[model samples]
Target: MDLSAINPVLLLASLLVAATPLLLAAIGETIVERAGVLNLGVEGMMITGAICGFAICVNTGSPVTGLVAAAIGGAALSLVFAFLTQVALANQVASGLALTLFGLGLSALLGQNYQGIKPPSFPRFDIPLLADIPVLGPILFRQDPVVYLALALTLATWAFLKFTRAGLILRAVGENHDAAHALGYKVIRIRTLAILFGGALAGMGGAYISLIRVPQWTEGMTAGIGWIALALVVFGAWKPLRVALGAFLFGGIEVVQLNLQAAGVAIPVEILAMSPYLITILVLVIMSADRSGAPASLGRSFHASH
Candidate 1:
């Protein structure tokens, strides 16, 4: 392998690009899980958002509108789950799975006319003084708005979960729903809001993919990134900064795999493509083995009577 063929700066930049979607989705899922709602439909929601964003961007010739539409689409899908879990008090896990299936079917139906179309490009923002620097300039300073937004969301999520009163109540609800309910907090309402927020962020991540990363429409375009994001929340022990770190790690692996293939490395393309998912399973196993930091009520349903 000609290691010199890989530019460290370019590799880092690619990692950032690949990591953004995962960061957004995982952070949002972290919030959802923290509020005692487990949504496994993230993959479906993301792909639906991807197609929705791509279609809207192509039709309107505007990436911004596409992203907004993606957020709306994702949130709308999540509302279904909220209705089932909150109003009907259905099983959270089952409802999430159904959401994924429904989103996939709906996105495919809506995207039939959008096949092979390219969406408008998202504009990149270059930091003033920093963007003018030599080799580091393009790598660090130039990126689409979502890249910066993902990082900002990480910090904001950390602060929200750690400092804000609403955040504290959300955490309390996740930790012990019975206690939070006794305290007069609307458990269902809080969880519903959290689920919607998660969906919107996940949708934005999907939009980033369609509008910027791949810049095209395809069925199941998100592949398994949503599942990876779910695993990342677990890998990070539901912490924002750690989840971001996990996203970067997976993103780096993906970038390296692609770059290696492009450079004519002897590795099989299938193996390289599978590396990201393999790593996700390994990380999940490691996290489960430790089992020290997982949210107390993850995947557990809460009822007022229980």
Candidate 2:
């Protein structure tokens, strides 16, 4: 158990990196849920985005293009979800589960050719002045653009949900679709758009895993991060900032386990492997006491005729 082998600076930096995917996925899902739609295909969207981004980046040799392709791929898969739930009025849970199965299979097929290939290097931003600060600089300012984008996006989502008229409409619909519809807001439109946005973010998270996290294609590389993001949305009570906080916390623990393993900690390998998910189970258990209810219309199909 060589605890000293773990570097705090590296651990903090890695924490941000690990948390980015979760933040991106959770924040996007936060918006979707806020609009009163529950989509469970996050895992599927993420894997699809992972393969799409990896394939595009490999072909074009551009991480930027790869990320874009990832978003598009995720959104494209999500469109199926939008149609089934928002258009065909299918059960949200069933549709979302199907989406995951489909995504996993689709990614396996797409990634068959991409196996063992390395992705292009992603450039990190080392802010000249800020990154020079002792301890804090490397921890906070020295990060990839995606980390900052996830943070900025969370803030923007918070502001939008709290202050914007469109946000209000979305919230209104989430609280009660029938009332929002009585006021002439397009319930289905709002939810469809929200689902698309969520899917895109989930995809970006997936890309981060392939293009940045592991920098290589592997079967089912996203693991269960999507489901963790789902737990975060509820853990944060649908608040963007809270969701972000939860992501960081979870990301921090994930990094800790990795560092511990690297440090030759005496902990059982099996226990270390399950540490992150253990935290998730603990969080969910803690949340059982929370009275912060979900959006009133969440998971309930919205029909214009109704």
Candidate 3:
């Protein structure tokens, strides 16, 4: 392995970009799971958002519009899950799986015409003075707004879950819906809101892939990152900071694998291609070994017994 072929600065910069989508998706899933609703259709929502964002951006020539539309599209699709599981009382897991399948097919159809189309570029903002600092400046200051937004969202989520009364109520609802219901808390209402919030974030993540990362529309382009995001929520033990760390870890692995492939490492092409996923699986296995941090009422259907 020729380490000299790799620029550590560029690798680190790419790491932040790579981790952004995962962080966005995982953070959204964390919210959903913490609200005691396990919507396993994050992949579905992500792809749907990808196509929607891509199409909108391509047609109107506005990345911002595309991103907003993506969020809206994702939330709209997730409402299907919310109605089934929360309102209609359908099985969360089955509904979630169905949502994923549906999303993939839907996105494929929507993106069929958009294949190979490039998107408008989002401007990167360089912080003056601070952005001029040695190595850290380029890595940290020279990034698009989404990267900074992702970091802000993580901090906001952490604060929300840790300090806010609303956060406490959301946690209570997740821990024991029955008790929360007894306290006159609207369990379904809170969960529905959480589900919507998660869906919007997931959609934005998908948009990031289409509008910024790859800067193009491709069918099934999310490439299982949504599943990784779900696993990351668990891997991070349902905490925002931990989730960010998990995302960065995966992002680093992805960057390393790609760098290895570019450097013409002797490793088999297929093996290098799958290294990030294989590592993610290994990490998940290690993280799930201790599941004590999980929300107690996760995946359970809630019905207020009058």
Candidate 4:
């Protein structure tokens, strides 16, 4: 293996790019779970967003439009789950699973013609002065706008959940929906909104994959990224910064593995390819060992009875 072939600076930048999708999805899922709703259809929503974004970009030749379309598509799909779980009071787990199935079939059908097609590229924002700095420039100052947006969202969500009144209400609802209901907060309305937000963010992440990461439309292109994002939410214990850290960690591993393979490293290609998933499982196991970081009411349905 040629050690010099792997540039540390480039490796870090690649990791950030790779982690963007997971960060976006995980942050969105974090908010949803915090609102006391568990939507397992993130994978479905993400792929649907991917196909929609790719298709729109191919048709319109605008990556921005494609991203917007992807968000709408993801939110639209989540509406199905929201309707079943929020309005119809259906089981959240089953409804989310169904949404995933629907999204998979829907994306496959929609993307049939789009297979192998490339989408417009997302624009990169290179910060002045900072981007020119040696070694650190690319790592810190050069990135797609979406990456910065994800970072801003992390801070915003953290502040919102920690300092804002609405955040308090949302957390209260998640912690005890019955008590929130007693206080006249509409639990369904809040949860529905959170679900929509989650779907949109996941969709945006999917669009990022099509527009910047993969740059092409393929069936099931998301390739379990949604599941990984879900696991990240847990691994981070529903915290935004920790979720981002987890994403970076996983992304770094993936990028390093790929680089090693490309550099003619002697490791098995299959093993390297599987490193991301393996790491995700390992992280989950270690986090589970602690058992104190998880939201107390995670995955439990909230019902209000008169």
What are the TM-scores, per candidate, against the unseen true structure? 0.97, 0.98, 0.98, 0.97
Model 3 per-residue lDDT at 129: 97
Q: On residues 205-228, what C-alpha lDDT tens digit does candidate 4 reach at each position?
A: 998898899788888889999999
**Candidate 3 minimal-lDDT segment of 10 residues:** 111-120
Please list all clashing residue pairs in model 2, or write none if there are none.
Answer: none
Minimum summed lDDT over a 10-residue window in model 2 is located at 288-297
Error of 1 at 177 (Å): 0.5
User: How does candidate 2 fare on TM-score?
Assistant: 0.98
Winner by TM-score between candidate 4 and candidate 3: 3
- Model 4 — TM-score against the truth? 0.97
lDDT of each: 0.88, 0.93, 0.93, 0.89
| Model 2: how far residue 185 lies from native, Å | 0.3
lDDT of 2 at 156: 96
Q: Residue 5: error of model 2 in Å?
A: 1.2
Tens digit of lDDT per residue, candidate 3, span 1-306?
Answer: 687989999999999999999999899999999999999999999999888988999899988899899999899999999999999999999999999999999999888888887788988989899899999998999999889999999999999999999999999999999999999999999999999999999999999999999888877899999999999998999999999999999989989988998888999989998987888889888987899999999999999864
Better of 1 and 2 by TM-score: 2
